[model samples]
Target: MAKSKVEYVCTECGDVSPKWAGQCAACKGWN
Candidate 1:
Protein backbone atom coordinates (compact mmCIF):
# COMPACT_ATOMS: atom_id res chain seq x y z
CA MET A 1 0.00 0.00 0.00
CA ALA A 2 1.07 3.56 -0.62
CA LYS A 3 1.55 5.95 2.25
CA SER A 4 -0.61 9.01 2.39
CA LYS A 5 0.51 12.40 3.58
CA VAL A 6 -1.51 14.55 5.91
CA GLU A 7 -1.69 18.32 5.78
CA TYR A 8 -3.42 21.05 7.77
CA VAL A 9 -5.05 23.73 5.68
CA CYS A 10 -7.06 26.79 6.60
CA THR A 11 -10.48 27.02 5.02
CA GLU A 12 -10.85 30.77 5.35
CA CYS A 13 -7.51 31.83 3.88
CA GLY A 14 -6.20 28.67 2.23
CA ASP A 15 -3.07 28.74 4.33
CA VAL A 16 -1.14 25.55 4.94
CA SER A 17 0.06 24.88 8.47
CA PRO A 18 2.60 22.43 9.80
CA LYS A 19 0.26 21.37 12.56
CA TRP A 20 -3.39 21.61 13.44
CA ALA A 21 -4.61 24.45 15.61
CA GLY A 22 -7.84 25.98 16.85
CA GLN A 23 -7.22 29.16 14.87
CA CYS A 24 -5.41 29.90 11.58
CA ALA A 25 -2.25 31.97 11.64
CA ALA A 26 -2.71 33.60 8.25
CA CYS A 27 -6.29 34.79 8.60
CA LYS A 28 -7.06 34.09 12.27
CA GLY A 29 -9.97 31.92 11.27
CA TRP A 30 -11.26 28.91 13.21
CA ASN A 31 -10.17 25.54 11.91
Candidate 2:
Protein backbone atom coordinates (compact mmCIF):
# COMPACT_ATOMS: atom_id res chain seq x y z
CA MET A 1 0.00 0.00 0.00
CA ALA A 2 1.08 3.56 -0.59
CA LYS A 3 1.82 5.82 2.34
CA SER A 4 -0.70 8.52 3.16
CA LYS A 5 0.49 12.04 2.55
CA VAL A 6 -0.78 15.57 3.06
CA GLU A 7 -0.36 18.28 0.48
CA TYR A 8 -1.60 21.66 -0.62
CA VAL A 9 -2.69 22.11 -4.23
CA CYS A 10 -2.69 25.43 -5.99
CA THR A 11 -6.16 26.44 -7.13
CA GLU A 12 -4.86 28.47 -10.06
CA CYS A 13 -2.12 26.36 -11.63
CA GLY A 14 -2.74 22.90 -10.21
CA ASP A 15 0.49 22.85 -8.29
CA VAL A 16 1.13 20.47 -5.40
CA SER A 17 2.89 21.36 -2.16
CA PRO A 18 3.95 19.15 0.71
CA LYS A 19 3.41 21.96 3.21
CA TRP A 20 1.20 25.03 3.50
CA ALA A 21 2.41 28.39 2.31
CA GLY A 22 1.06 31.92 1.94
CA GLN A 23 1.64 31.89 -1.81
CA CYS A 24 1.72 29.19 -4.45
CA ALA A 25 5.11 28.40 -5.88
CA ALA A 26 3.75 27.44 -9.24
CA CYS A 27 1.31 30.21 -10.05
CA LYS A 28 2.37 32.75 -7.42
CA GLY A 29 -1.18 32.96 -6.17
CA TRP A 30 -2.06 33.89 -2.62
CA ASN A 31 -3.36 31.02 -0.65
Q: How well is each residue in 6-31 modelled by candidate 2, as lDDT tens digits?
A: 99888888899999897998889998
Per-residue alpha-carbon lDDT of candidate 1 for residues 1-31, written as tens digits (9 for 90 to 100): 9977778999999999878998999999998
Residue 10, candidate 1: Cα error in Å is 0.3
> How much lDDT does candidate 2 score?
0.90
TM-score of 1: 0.70
Worst 10 residues of 1 by lDDT: 2-11
> Clashes per prediction?
0, 0
lDDT of model 2, residue 8: 89
TM-score of each: 0.70, 0.70
Runs of candidate 2 with Cα error greater than 4 angstroms are 1-3
